[model samples]
Target: MASGTSQAPEDGGVMPSRAPELLSGNPDVTPDAIRATEKKKVEAPYGQWKSDITKEALFRGSRKLLSPRVCSRTGRTFFTEARPDGIYHLVEASQSGATYSCHTVLPEGYSARSRVYEYGGGADDGKGDDGDAGPRVIFCNFSDCTVQILDVDTEKVTCLLAESDTLRYADFAAPPRPGSPWVLAVQEDHASAVPDQVRNYVVVIHTATGEVRRAVEGADFYMYPSFSADGGKIAWVQWDFPDMPWSGVKLYWADWNDEDGAVSNVEWVAGEDGMTVTEPRWGADGFLYFCYEKTNYRQFYRRRPGGDMALLDLKRYEEAEFGSASMFIGSHTYAILSKECIVAVATENGSDKVIAFNPETLQSQDLSLPLSEITYDGLYRLSDTSFIVIGGGDTTPQAFYLVDITDNDDGARDNRKLTNIRWSIDEVLNPEIFSTPQHIHFSAKSGPKREIHGFYWPPHNLEYKGPEGTKPPLIVQSHGGPTGHTGPGLALSMQYWNARGYATFAINYSGSDGHGKTYRELLNGRWGAIDVNDIAESVRHLSSSTSTPPLIDGRRVGIRGGSAGGYSVLQALCQHPALFAGGACYYGISDVKLLLQETHKMESHYVDFLLFTPGMTDADKEQVMRDRSPVHHAGNITAPLLICHGEDDKVVPISQAYTMYDDIRARGGEVKLVKFPGEGHGFRKGGELAQGA
Candidate 1:
């Protein structure tokens, strides 16, 4: 490999000397030149050849597995799995002889999905078997957004409520009492002239009578309607406009009437003011346990009947997040085991672990599971010392595991054992081709030397190696949610790049979750600047020859992301054009001001926190928004770019991509735009995903 010289063009732009040579074609073609060209095309670079990890495999191989629930009476674990046919099936798994028998509980053509708030949650929940009613599962039908019940014995599916296009339901819970036919769920009604006028609240559905009645109303959003063990009390969480659940929420509880099926004496329990609360669960001891953020970190608190709330202190682990931001309903962070113990998942430094805390003693016992990270709301305690969780490591995909803590006679650190209940996908791809991520921390660009974190995955392939003395290209990935964290899981999409001779870096830039509140607020009023700088610095850090040999080729660095991450990619390229060779933006936001006006109601006020400053005039705020928008600076992005968007995306519409493509093309820059029909904010169909990959 030869080093290329950087030169300043007469147009006041920096240009590489090797750029012209790579783009120019020789006018005089000789027989030797033609032969050389043929040889170069036929022989591919090491690790760059097509392998078994094709685009189809990348999309179809990994199964969508989430929301694990255990039936206490039958000890059967059930979960939702998205099959290759685009239908989400409810699967039930029973353990036997070093393996598990898994069967689909839902009939053909039935999908357990919810579209409430666009990103649905609490799609399915099961009721334990009673002598009279037998076993049943309640779920939100994706086809009509109506609540449906499935009989475990008869396998008969029946709608609990009449199907209506204006009504959607999620986050369901059935009373623990046997022979109980009433189900509690959050309902969203869209029968209004104005979309923003739609009503959201909690409702009770009588399975036997097929009657749906409002249980709680007057709140903009409601979730997690839980019933106590005795069925005498109920609890839930609610939030209003201009404030997402992550920003603030209110927890409420009231007495339940089994005969009348109504709630009374409703009172605010916790999460008043601007505190964020989530996942309210009733313990066996008749105490209400929920997660709330009073300090900088989210932690668990318990409230006894007629008593004030008390913190469940895990003394050694005081700085971790006990609950995650409520992006969707059914975000379970903790579960009750017995009257004295609680099993919870806590996150620190962008990783998650399962811990058992005794509320009586206020001490935590570390359940040393084999996996490094656990999925959010994956913990379900079946017995006093036994539980099930979905988790994975750097090279492992998310899978279900049965964990037993009853044999913890040795101690807290090394007592528990885990049995793999099921894998998200069969291990068909070669493990040798998978690359493990190294957690890298580098200094922020303009902050007070604060550290920015990212996962760096180097190219790995057993069959091929890069050309001698040459570094592989790098792809910088920005995760969505701007508030969401990218965990160290073996994602097939990231591995696809690694297997194809590319180094990948996933940045958890400022404003990302898992970090403390102070670090998460680093992007407040500086969304584009802070995130873009962090991404650019990450690329520079990997490209510099700090090690014996650089891990990435600086001249071939590119950026890519979806949603908020896509916004970061576009801004990074426009702000630092010379640093990135090219970029790929999927449903990215190019104009902040436009997004603020057109985004969904759930995130309508989100831009106020990311872009607005206090006491700024309307004109001043508009200038700031335009100044940070990538569309306004498209001329600055000289590198080649690829933009993709779903035609039905409501969050960041396709017009954003079209405007960006047109702007870059008008400036004489290379650009391409691809739009998918019938797709929304995220691609779901296998064909669309394969093409995007």
Candidate 2:
């Protein structure tokens, strides 16, 4: 409790400044000696102490919960559970008078999963009219991408339509009504061509006849196909290659002929400038609502049926983004709550807020809740007063919750109600095991003094503390997506190191999305080089920190990351060969050109934006790719390295991992390789995850 002492957020961090006698500089009386003399509690080195939060404990009593949605007709909620064994089971929750009962809807062999663009989305939905015919649930079968419907009333799942391995469907949208017979969906046709040439189009499924017809087609990619309140018109998001949805996309709308389930007179609406527009939904007020970053941060925007697009004039939106990228299908952050109000997830500085706003006046208020991060497709409309969402917090894991709200846009406010229905993990460990993340701002030294955002977690454990006169080693984590972000919330990956007595810092570098589009574009044309500089500056900023006693030992440092972050780890080690003790890269990229050529259709041209300018010749672009790729510079890495990869990874092939390992080993650099069988992109099994730990 002393003034200059370092108090861990939850754990007793560094020992209080030694007694005054120890402060009295005496060469023979070392600080460690004085600290031992002044010690009043049991001394144990960090990371070596016994702790209850083991690596295996993360998944012991835990389950991986996917998207959750509520049926507007009957308040029936549906969500999916992903098991380590690879089957994604769909669960439906229905009210039994006063309680909700969750039951798995699929048989043992069927998995409700979508593989559109191979990134996978458009999995399941509990959409239907108020008629008692049955609650119709749309499910995409993982094994063969079949589009099936579950009749919850009879617990019978029947084929709405069947698909082959070459055909996948997702991003399903059903008009809100009483007797709509068809739903619109996006279809990915892989049998049509190779990876980049795969055919993507929008299709309409007629429930009565089980007939499928193409409604929109000939675009590189399509997403968010939506119909107006009366089903008279439709809107969808589209974009071409060399531009991802988060980078450049267009919003389009068309008149729908309900009798024939066909869209006509389709025309480009918004996104003329192509600035990251997505999730277009027509509000009850007859206005199309969506999230667009035209103003540099993806903010709330609404469009009249045939009028201009206008940004919501809310205060908070000036600093916060309404939603994230549309990398995968089936994710939506905002929902129309009523004719006067709409609710959306607003993200600012790595945190989330569910906000309610009026389309006419743009009056908005943050709904008070215990949730932290709301996953994609997390928001669903239950009624004008309530909704369902899946979220996790600092001390809580992910769970499904029913949120009820008073009208915030009606010129008044009241407390919001959040009811937990089911939890991914029910047991809460000792509070001492949690290390609250402290949001910190530092500047990248090599850049033009741009501020860098990150979260710093001090080593924390209920029973252990670092020995006197020493600081915890630092682990600088670079997050994936390069376009993605490391949020300010409870993350097992962030806390895993904290439980072991290591200080950790997660960087949301310049290209990260939560900040704003201006910052998000900072990595364009300078991915590898700029991100490396920012990370290096972060190490210096933390090492030479102005705190009473430095929080981390810069001399004993390591860099860790996965995917895009993994690539950063390798680049950081090579850029500052003498700065780190070692590095861990999980399915990280080693060759830039290989990634550009071999990545999925969604990101095939993403590296083009990252590594080259618009006018660069083919030769110049190739030179830059070679220059920025870490494998080309592996000889510069002096520290030991560990690399892990999934043999089935299509995003970044295992071949990339093999190439990096071979190059490092051939260069006489200390490197190790670990491979997981049947795992792709990310490890799912608890044992494999723990082994990497």
Candidate 3:
């Protein structure tokens, strides 16, 4: 053979070219031929395609962590992170290299959660420094409903109150100074026979001796008990039955005699005549600040020591809500940073923003928040110009950010200084696969000039494209609290559908929160009728719109929701049978009358506002309840329905689902019911969620 040259074939045939040898594949297969074959494989259709956002993704140990609390003594921030194990861990934030490190503060199996009112809050609060011993923390344990103290120095957890399953405590508040040596909490007694007679009061627990004693009583319900900076005064909100906390509440304050350990000179300051008052905070200067809904909106108000209440002037800004309806125990909208400055979270058009206000000057400036949605009770003031908040945008699920407002010029410019220190998930998902929400406003036929709002999210899949010219199926989600508004935050469950080529729409119907008082009250005395109409109208508006993408199929729509939203789902499918292809109801109410009689004490009187008319007789109310119940009108439903209920649910009993299932099946309608054994109103167990998904 010649050096650096090709050799002759052994068979005496012409030698092949060097291209096939370099390619090193089938000799006859050219590069162009291989490329064509791969292209055909990419375009070929197999069976139905699956996505990475599978049921496992939906049931995975992902969580939406919130409630950031920074310790003044240690300068370390602590927050609760909920996980698929159905437990919440008190996490301490630290830094490692360029990444954040989360250290679990609580011991294994010790969940820092409260079951008060079944919506749990006020479970954790930072205790001020005890002399030179650093700051302590008081938290409620879900295991035994006992209040516990976490000693920062020792890293030891000790029960501040003896463990008792019958007695539950939440909404913790520590005195500003260690002289009191006690923590204030709301105590809920579950041993009472009469639901109305259950004892709920503000109590004080001795930090050292673990002794608990009543601090304030004489009210049907008490929540958010807060001590003044001097520890010489205390304030809280109370409400009676036939009225929810959001419907009406009285703000009361009393002079505290710390030496004698008594409350005296108590007086009802505000909240009368079905007015809602919440988040009563005492400023450093002794003025009591709170959110009051006297007008159509819940606005920020401050009352001087002996003067009347006045609204903080925010007329220059667009009309918005300063506070959320008191649905849970620790729902806070604003935090008083100093006597003159306050940081508040407000909602407008289904989005939330942080604002800094000068209570004295009545001047306000919007803080440039990176996220469109701020979690309730997420704002914590670290200083006059700095704070920490838990929020999420269209792509970020939920994360903690240190926000600085020192540069805010009180103008329209983006003055927010933000730094992300921690995330809810360990690994960040691809943002391209997440669907961003588009705010849509549509008019409803039933309400005439009334407009309905919703967040419309189109399907997004970076790797997959649906069959050409085929529209995606639509899923209309009804939020749990008909009073709850669906904000424009990234939701993994919503993204799961979007990634799988399904469009999702979350409706803030007539009765949803965040749209001011008038909108929230739209479902009053017309719950089933108005909510159903608004949901149907939202679907109809999207289906008939010319701007809708061809990828959205008008005729293929489904509805799903839990609790109040589930009720709306069932009602909408029953009333507008031809509008939906299927529906999913989770722990939904099928009988309003039964719900009124058998529901939990916290919501026992909720039906009075939903189904009752002032002048109607008992018979009339009963007839109306029956007429509005989906179980009674199962024959009207034509769409296939799936009903899932927690067997232990007390808010909307499993019986509600059972009755609806039987009624629809007896009517020869398409229906299926699934029950989760150890679940409640909401499924928290990992196995349960996996099974349900």
Task: Report clash pairs, candidate 3.
Answer: 122-171, 471-551, 472-551
Residue 116 in candidate 2, Cα distance off native in Å: 0.8
- For every candidate structure, what is the RMSD over all alpha carbons to the true structure, in angstroms? 11.4, 8.1, 11.4
Candidate 3 or 2, higher TM-score: 2
Sliding window of 10 residues with minimal summed lDDT for model 2: 5-14
lDDT rank order: 2, 1, 3
lDDT of each: 0.77, 0.77, 0.76
Model 3 residue 523 CA deviation in Å? 0.7
User: Which of 2 and 3 is ahead in lDDT?
Assistant: 2
Give residue 504's lDDT in candidate 1 (0 to 100).
94
User: Which candidate should be chosen as best, given TM-score against the real structure?
Assistant: 2
lDDT (tens digit, per residue) of candidate 3 on 227-300: 88778888999988787877778899988776656778988888986788888888888888888888877788
The lDDT of model 1 is 0.77
TM-scores across all candidates?
0.89, 0.90, 0.89
Query: Measured by TM-score, how close is model 2 to the native structure?
Result: 0.90
Candidate 2 wrongly placed segments (more than 4 Å): 1-41, 96-99, 407-411, 546-549, 691-693
